[model samples]
Target chain A: MTAPAAPQTAPSPAAAPAGAPAVIRAIHLSKVYELGAQQVRALDDVSLEIGKGEYVAIMGPSGSGKSTLMNVLGCLDVPSSGEYWLRGQEVSKLSEDELAEIRNREIGFVFQTFHLLARQTALRNVELPLVYGAVRADERRARALELLRQVGLEKRADHKPNELSGGERQRVAIARALVNRPALLLADEPTGNLDSRTGKEILELLDRLHGEGHTILLVTHDPEVGRRAARTVRVRDGRIESDAPNR
Target chain B: MIALLEGVRIALQAIWGQKLRSALTLLCVIIAILSIIAVVSVLDGMDLYVREEVAGAGANVFTLRRVDELKVLTDLQVFLDSLGNPRITLADWKALRAEMTLAEFVDPLRSRSGDLQAVRDGRSIRNVDLQGRGAEYPGIEDLDLERGRHLTQADIDQRREVLVIGAQVAETLFPGVDPLGQKVRLSGRHYEVVGVFARRSNVLGQDRNIFAILPLSALFAQFGSFRSISVQVKAKSLGDFAAALDEARTIMRVRHGLRPQDPDDFNLTTAEQFLTLWEKISSGIFATLIGVVSITLVVGGIIIMNVMLVSVTERTREVGLRKALGARRGMILFQFLVESVTLTSVGGVVGIVLGFAAAFLIGAFSPLPYSVKPWSIVSALVIVFAVGVFFGLYPASRAARLQPVEALRRE
Candidate 1:
């Protein structure tokens, strides 16, 4: 299966709808967790489609299974039943290593806590995925530098995660997420740890990236955060409560 | 290859993050390898020193004495039994000198060790080993002359009061003056120094350059008759050595009137025998030292394993992050292995340097000579690498086996 490149133009409007050329296609996906003698259904028949260059947000309250849906969509976890396709490959049946390759080549993740390796400088953290991807050192450096420049953290390239402020750390994480030019930028509460002003800055960065034809998926509990996306999908009780384009 | 280099970089960073813990772990590795290299170097040095210095007899020469030093050392009962054997008399030496056909030279030796002092005016040297030798002594042994000539046949036959003093005695008794033709008193008699032997290295703390050699006739005139003499015999060629030894043995047995049914009382010592004896002693020391070193390395290896286990646990989330970034299981394992090997190899290098310095100091101050073999250093590195792999396997695999989802979930 070919990697889905970032489109050169904005996605074919919002609400990519069903049966489109999707970056992610989930068909009746379900996930179950056995907590000792009790079985908790984390995802129940959750089907979703994300198209190239589309910016979508997954939102839900605590224990609402939105995190579970993001995990399945990001190839971090496989569903208990049903097929999840990413970039035309049936990823639900892929092996751990194959899934890891997909995650590296097709999806990029920005976490809530900005899980940058504390020991590495900002540039090293951005170059990490490419290092694992077996990219040459010079090329990895050039690409990571470009992404750091794009995130406006080029001046702080040599600084460690602890040396950066919360907003700068999140920008570094964003640079790291986009360094690979992944098909989908998956952000799980990317602004959860930031103040409103810094959070708004991060949201603007994501909006600018969406305008550049990069597909974006934001998972957050904040309705205001969800409202920034062109499309919002609300999850509740292991099921999709609503998935519709924002006004 | 690139991944391994990256792994090394990361490993160094991780190790630097926990300075105290890594230091303690490295200490154990250093001590273990230090002991191994030091002991091996000293043993190797001693082996070479003994081969060159203690085996003083020429390849074609053998000595016949009253009791066998080898048998006495190997068995205490042999020591007691040999005390009862008759002394090798000068008459027996004379007979062997006349009857031996395979021998090229037959020289009689008589040595006295205790309270033997050489005096020149007021300057005196104590604990000087005094030896009585025939004119053939220089031919049977590789004795070098630093000045003047050795004793001639005329000097030995006419009982001339002549001596060949070692370099140490020459330096002490006649510091500014020439020792040749100078009178030195030994055994209550004065003898003119004819020659000075070349300076020699010490053997097992025994100074080789403090002795004095005298003509056999002169020694007897001063100290009475010879008792338990050792006759040094040299064969005509390398091929004749065994034949000459057998002929001398037979001649001594006949002279002592020993029948075929009775065991010979005298001992025959060759250059080869001396080497074999030295080898036996050195090998025993080597084996014992190696045994102790192995235990230390194992303990060190265990410490490394424990430290690695803790490191793996501490970096569980980092491992998850790496996996999430597309690091394969093999890459993870390789990373950890590189870290372990790097740690041990550092310890090994430090140990080798310290051990070599220790050996060098020992050689400088003592009788042993230091030898640095490239293979020994290579083998030491290989050993530490093996230990790292052996101990690092469990913890590295534990890190590799961690599920990325579970690991990322860990707080």
Candidate 2:
């Protein structure tokens, strides 16, 4: 299935039922931390709606709770005292197993570190999600090879992650993220470990994916990266400072 | 379930990464199974030899001796009481042989208590077992002559000073030169060698080739009177053996006037009894072997658990990466369990190979034949697998319990 599979506009007024969901909707979401005696708020009273086929960047400096919002939005973590609805289902009350099922089926995560299993080849690493998805070995191998070809790494499909350059590793991670054809591509600092020359190449890949009607959420501390998105949400001090559409 | 194959692949890779440590960990388990199998094989071989060779070959042949005790010595009271009881003698043998209608042959055999020596022209062999036998003894005991002729009934009727030595005694006393008709002195009495026995069977690791046999009449004439001796009785066939044994027992009991309530003072030893006694002894040895081996497995398992825990801690980041890639906790747990089972099962296979080699060595160099009990091998596999599962649980679960975020951040 492709992104915007059941596209719903952001906060439609009286045109749709209350039960209809956008791609992602968070209502008064909050996350509190308990470090010894201190209760630091990671997210507080944040409400947001992300529709289908939207490239949204959550930009913030360190400790500005952008990571927290990304985790909550990707279903890696649950928010405190709030409701999170993804693909028309409330997930705040879901158990860990249910949340894991949601993550595997609905969200594709791209990490800054690449997180490729070091011992496995690029093809094997790409096929990991399909393995957990109960796909047969022959089909998984074929699909993983296809994904590698899309990222222009067909020749390097048998190479381990360490054998590849930083940009190549990021591309492999992107291929892995899209292998499951998840509705939302959630990338957390997809180019944080790359140089500017390599980082721009990764951003170009993201731009092409978005052009093909993929919903992308890029979280970064760099403003240059944030500006590439059509919509940017700037977070500071555990709250959103700006939510605006860019040209 | 499909991921089990992948789990095995991962486990193999992990073991390959630490080859030396894996070998060392397997050493304890290897040695445990090796020694257990080797020891059990030896005991099993002994039981085989006891049944096949030492039980006197044929089921129709049985011995009537003084004591029923097979391996364990009789208690002091039983021994003292047996000493008071009448010794099995020539008259008792004759009387028992006369009353048996189903009997084929009865041979009276008298053995000297201490060691006997034979000397010929300054060459002497000490520790030669001396037994005086009737002419029927050769047929009943199946002693094949390698040289010369057996003592005829005339040798016993005339009370001739004729002797038959074993092949080894002939080799020791009269090497190279003809031992037939050679005179050998025993206890200051000279006797002409009439026959030599063939070296065929090895019994209880003792040299049966060092036997010295003489006529019972000559033995009585030289040693005053026959006192303590055993009589071997052979039945006509397997079908009538029970009736033959009952007739002998009845004649003997009537001769001794044994009351119904009183147990027979004489002991009856059948080939079956000897085999059962061996089984009892070997099973005890097997039990002891299992006890010693289980200790090794316990110690080995504890070491494996410690090593696995360290491995889990070392590979925490890899676990986090797998979990993030959609692996469930059960998958992670199964992966580690497979690793340990692979380690021990590999050890078990190696141990069995080494154990068979050891048994072969014993068979090649020693009198004991290499006998491997099938159950011992099955138990070794079952035991090693159990140790792996039992010891690997804590570490595997610890690895599975690690949170993806926490593990990803670990060094």
Least accurate 10 contiguous residues by lDDT in model 1 chain B: B113-122
For the record, the alpha-carbon RMSD of candidate 2 to the native fold, in angstroms, is 3.9
Best by TM-score: 2
Residues B1-411, candidate 1, lDDT per residue (tens digit)? Answer: 667778888888878888898888888888888888877887887787677665744878898888877866667787678778888878877888899998889999998762333454668788888888898988877789999999888998999989898999888888888988888776577788899999986777777898888888787888788477888889989899899989998887887789999887888889898788778877888888899899999999998899999999999999998888788788889888877887888888898898888878888887667788888899999999999999999999999888877788787
Please identify model 2 stretches exceeding 4 Å from their true place.
A1-20, A28-46, A60-65, A79-81, A92-98, A234-242, B26-28, B56-58, B69-77, B113-120, B373-379
For candidate 2, lDDT tens digit of each residue in A1-247?
Answer: 1222111233422233454356787777899989889999999877777777889989999999998899889887789868888887899889766776677677888999988888889999898888767688999999999988988999999999999999999899888888888878999999899999999999999999999988899999999998899888888988878777776
**How well does chain A score by TM in each candidate?**
0.92, 0.92
How close to the true structure is residue B198 of candidate 1, measured as C-alpha lDDT? 96
Superposition error at A183 for model 2 (Å): 1.7
lDDT (Cα atoms) of all candidates against the true structure: 0.85, 0.82
Off by over 4 Å in 1: A1-21, A27-54, A80-82, A154-159, A211-213, A230-232, A236-247, B15-35, B75-84, B117-124, B146-149, B152-163, B170-195, B216-226, B256-263, B299-303
Q: What is the lDDT of residue A171 in candidate 1?
A: 95
Residues B87-114 of candidate 2 have per-residue lDDT tens digits of 8888888886787788788888887732
